[model samples]
Target: MRDVQWIYSHEVVARPQSQQPTARIPAPTSAMQTCGPLLFAACRRRGRPSPADAVCRCLVIHLSARHDGTARRGGSVAATTKPSRLAASPTLPRVPIPTRTRSRMHLHQLKPGEAASLPRHLLEAHVVALVRRCCPGLLALRAAHARLIRLRLPRLTAAFALSKLLASSSSCGAAPSYARNLFDQIPEPTAFCYNSLIRALSSAAGAAPAADTVLVYRRMLRAGSPLPNTFTLAFALKACSIVPALGEGRQLHSQAFRRGLEPSPYVQTGLLNLYAKCEEVALARTVFDGMVGDKNYAAWSAMIGGYSRVGMVNEALGLFREMQAADVNPDEVTMVSVISACAKAGALDLGRWVHAFIDRKGITVDLELSTALIDMYAKCGLIERAKGVFDAMAERDTKAWSAMIVGLAIHGLVEDALKLFSRMLELKVRPNNVTFIGVLSACAHSGLVNEGRRYWSTMQELGIKPSMENYGCMVDLFCRSSLLDEAYSFVTGMAIPPNSVIWRTLLVASKNSNRFDIVQSASKKLLELEPCNPENYVLLSNLYASNSQWDRVSYMRKKMKENNVNVVAGCSSIEINGYLHKFVVSDDSHPEIKEIRLLLREIADRVVRAGHKPWTAAVLHDVGEEEKEVALCEHSERHGSWLPALTGNATTMSTVGVYSTARQIFR
Candidate 1:
């Protein structure tokens, strides 16, 4: 309002030395003239104006000065060599000159709670709007939160801000406890607040058990107000799916149905997934059918996934086909289940078809789906294709690497498997128990005794305890290498009790080596653990006969008959064009038995010509030497190998006829 001297002026005006020659500045601009002293006086009187009002005033002043070509460089005002009209006018009040400190004071120094004259409702509205904009960043949010607490913001406004913080933290992968702490500080959280916390906890994998979601939901229910909505049941059902809590999930379903919320798409999908994950496929199907043609992609996917998880491979494939026929598009989740079903069935053609479909449809090969593809290719005996997919992955997670390593391990590619494991470590990807299992199995299968010991030590160093499967692999490693004493010692010294699988591995190894010293203990332990497994009795019988203990063998046989335990005969299978042909020892059920027998005679003649005599020691029957040799030639496994050769061309003979036998040494 008064003539204020320009701070960046290069010239001084003429004045008396004693008076300091008060510098004459130009009148205030028209825009400032219109506002006059009212805005600044109000702000000065009120301590601080609203941030928005302050910002608006700054923009107006800057734009007005710029339009008049009076803006100067370095944010300084341009000085004019003219007398100020305001200085001569005695009818006006003087306005304070705007400075950096005053501008900042108006913007940031305002205490929100100090605005007492403003209605409480309007203050809370401003805080809510501020929180909505700040929700995307934690730092901005915390700063906002601090300002609110410092100003003692209304409880409702603070609660909403805390709720947003919890939701944002959940999405950003912050610890759920951080949100829990914030939630606890609220005096009384609304249903929205409770739902925010529940949803956050529901999605936090590996942080807490799914049961935590159930507990939070119970707390909400008991709060007696701000009751749950459809979103609440949806998240609760998902948590139940994670825990596979069929009982809790069913209760939620009943509650939702009673409340007329079951028709909600989100709630229905969650319930369907819950029952499916709980392996109640029938219930899941009921949920699906009740929709009466309202099934979405997720509903179909959940049904297919349920069947696949329960090992109903055929049903899964059938449903997948039905899903396609119904014109319902499949997402990555659905294809993952379809690929997994193909893996279980060893349907290589079908797996390839799915892979081609993915490429054709431009579906994203995300980590989970890529892992499933690797597993499918590997299990279908296409390790090369599995490796191709593994190599093509742009980002490999633990699951992808583990699946590839396990695939190689099962295919006897021990070197490749271990190399991949080493590479995974070098890449700083922490190998979990599943990864260790694959590496240990590779070592076991490849007879790498030193490597097995090294890995076992490394596993311990990595703070991974040897699971039952790991222990079994170690036992198998020693057994395969004919170190029976070490194998037995390893089993007995296990930190955890040896499982039936470990005992079976040791028993079979002992029988093969004729190490009867270890047999008695291993057999007793095996029988104790698996009393009804007829294979165990058969193994004991065979072991006794191997040692020429005919009387004991007969006693074992009589006991088996008394127990009505029929042995599971060893069988070998060959896959030809997706059809599997299985053969049991002494089986004559095949229509091509005549040709198979003739091929067997030819193979026996050829083997005799090659100077390889039949080994009859494996014959468990108490018979003469000639009878044993004849039985050996008539073994179904021997016929199984020869049938494919006689039935197919030379190429098929080289590939298809070489079926792996399913015979165990103990049997």
Candidate 2:
């Protein structure tokens, strides 16, 4: 050091852009400055300054990239300089790492080939293990695991301790860390360690697992340990899937495959489960398609469920047929998926065929299967068949009752749904969130303001925390019932957080009930939530126009244009026979264009002769009175009617169905 020369920033006029110095540059100091420009130019001219530039650049790189633990944005090197309290201390290093732990952390703990190779999440999990142990139950388990990690400790003692902790309080916090001295002692894990963790994960199925699971996985991966059996993969896959760690799951899948675990039915199903949760449907299907023989019931069910959720009902039903042709048995899930496909496609005939198949198989109507059947029939216009299914059931769950209630509500049987709701409560099967949504919708449809209000209050009394959907239901319910003040108060005073759906529901409700005073505020919030949702923009403008706020209407319309929120053209469709014939409100695009025009004239003439006035307020257009009236009468449902007509379908009863709401109205 006495023979060596150290240059400070000011002493070095400049430095060349190069890599590290062979010797020390300068010690950390309170004040720091950049090298002079002249020195930089001179250093560039000679290889003499390469070492200095290297050392300087290396110091900056170290500070910016890793020294302070602030992960640098990729590709760009940044230097962070801050004052250290060590500058004033006599014995401490001038550069200090920010840390809060009272005990010293050995640097060798993060040495090469140590647990540092573990995934970042697992490393964080290890950090959590260091902090738990303030509670008595967890304290006991921590001591037991520590003892088990040591020599001469009976495995059963640790097992019993972990079991007692899980059984006593399902909500124990983080795990207790093993001792620092135990790092060098890589003893083989006994059977007890694996068994305890798995049992605890199974018992805590309702909740997510503690991060200890990840830590153990990391340790296993680092050691090239033998793979866990089918049950372990199944459980671990579920835990990983719940956290939605796509990368970790993919790694686990690779390990499973490497260990020849691919064909295991449970493992494959677990793979599908994980993929479906990740919304990687293609992967899930690929795994399902690779099954060697007739798949197990759970495997088939997982595939059907995956397709059903991804809106591929046709494929789901097709797979069901494929399974059936292979002599595989169909269960409630398969039946439910088939019925749901029928409802989505509006295939009433196919739905009836499924019902017959279910009967032939002697499949009894459980609550879920029965509920799906009821919904399929109701949606496909076979209300009578749906009611029959409801009546045939030996027993009903709250969902079954809600299904019927909702079907009746959709068909304008509000009183009927209410009666069934009362029956559900009397049966002592507690109603869930979906059940309340259905019943409240009934109140919305029937304009039962008092009944809807009472139900909203009763939800909290029943100890059910109202969700965002529940509040959306209440807002739309009040809005439909013309209880503007009540709907407004409910949304504004919600204890739980309000969501975009709640705001949008209030906005739409305002338009219907003519509550224009607060429409602007609701519309503003709606735009904030869904700035790119074109419907909200058009609907808000329509709301202003309906309430006679013509000036604000013009401003909103102009703003909507300025923001490029072009309204999608409103096309109406009617289902006639077996076809859907689409008709634009203003343009003629149907193959049956001539007939649609002629029918429109007939409907208009009949309207005038019958003395039924056209309510132009409901029309979502900025046209003149005559044009708006014509648009109102030529809705999509009117065109949909031509669909049935073209397909040789006929309506015996003169019922009118509104296109916008998707509900039929009997005249």
Candidate 3:
């Protein structure tokens, strides 16, 4: 037999088969031999001889000489052959095995059927390199895919590469359909492949794609060859959250429990987000409480955000405090949720404190967080602060611009809102439906009918199909301008069905205009749309009482009783010293109710002395004039207004609406 030299660990040994040690160094396998020339060519192309070049040259020479039968039988090839330069070089650098292996797997040199000769680990590495290089471009990815197919790699190897390609396609702005097609091409795909597709589609832009994410996840469940892992459950749960598939989310929650993946941080957070987003706060809390280990910020943020979404402001604030107690630093997301809750509660002082905390902690205020701050400040009656935050933002997206415009509009800063909108258009910041709502609202507030119409047309021209809120704003615009006929016409002519808010707007405006016919019609539509809304019943009853239709007013009351609809008492909240105090009409629940009542009486007496008269005509009850005045004095907003009097140092107070008597006193 011919003698051969084999690389054994760190050394090259040459010997004939008969004389070889029992513990022989095996000859270079077909993988190394096939890949050797490819590695050598790669080194040459770099125009530099690396340590890999020496290794590859030695491999090629030994393999070639052996196959060509250059060594005669029974002769010592070591004596006949010059020693390999690698063995002779006293200071030869060690070849980086991984580097050489990776270099040989380049897509250009990698051919069909040749990859099969490579070890499984090397083939996987090659597939990873192929994916990374080609994932960014669809055309390049398809080419790499074709090469992968031609090579006919093992199933697991191809699936791994294809799974990566599937995920990258979904995230790199490729259509979900492309990802679906790639997923279909995967033969007996593993849970990893299903997870990759599910994750990509879950975060897709629209509900339809998110639904597809759930579908892919279900397919994984049905296949059942490879059960869903922790990542699979996490991604699938996220899709359920986005689709708001509450039933599916619950099912996944159970699956997590059965699989014992409930303890996984990813799965637990996903469950929390799923329940929280679906408005199932109680269920979400159960899941949250079960997270016994070290909780991350995401878990806390998701829970707090759930409370904020449902307008459970107190709960959200309490959770935020708990998060702080846990020593978890609030990120921008946490702050956004907290600020949103404060806005809902009108907890101005608390909002300010949260803002200060953000600044003190040096948290990065991204666009979403900044927008939330603007909205919170605006709703808290701090328009100037909102404007400051808006101006301070280094970059503004559409939502940021819309938030500022909406804030100004609600605060009745019509000119500023309009000017800001104009600037937004000038800066090429495309206005969405929300932006038009603010524009139309500003016009409605100022009774600028022409400007409202102009902006409405501009919004349509920008291809922004009007949403329900946008249509509501336009209806309000016409109604506030005393164009009751136009408002009615606009509602009837809307492409989409007018919701209760639009009818309610028309009803209020018509009642204020004393157009009983319009009020009757609007109220009928509003009641039909939202039969349980006590405000609609009260408004209609008040309209009847104004016309001395006592029997009709009684009928309305009877209808409310029959429907079990109780009037929602007017409620207002004021924040002082970081505590939120709420007051309803004649509320006696406050711990300092006596002090508030005493201060209120004093303020009322002073306002009466100042020649202020309470407007009791709007009172719906058919009572004596003195009783109407008393009822007006006992209004919820009037009760809220006395908070500053009780707290002496309170600079700002917010109320739903105060009686004329209270308004003058508070101002």
Best by TM-score: 3
Clashing pairs in 3: none
Candidate 2 per-residue C-alpha lDDT over 575-666 given as tens digits, one digit per residue, 9 for 90 to 100: 33323345565666667776766777787889889988888877756679898777765676666555455445556423322233334432
Clashing pairs in 1: none
| Predicted candidate 1 versus true structure: per-residue lDDT over 509-598, tens digit per residue | 988898877888988898788777887787788778888889989988788888788887766654455444567777788787778877
- The per-model lDDT (C-alpha) reads 0.73, 0.62, 0.77
Candidate 2 global TM-score: 0.61
Question: What's the CA error at residue 285 for candidate 3, in Å?
Answer: 2.1
Provide backbone clash counts, one per model: 0, 13, 0
* Backbone clashes in model 1: 0
Off by over 4 Å in 2: 1-216, 222-224, 228-231, 240-265, 277-280, 290-294, 512-514, 544-639, 651-667
True lDDT of residue 499, candidate 1: 76
- Return the candidate ranking by TM-score, descending: 3, 1, 2
Best of the two (2, 3) by TM-score: 3
Give one digit per residue, the lDDT tens place, for model 3 in 262-284.
88989989999999999999999
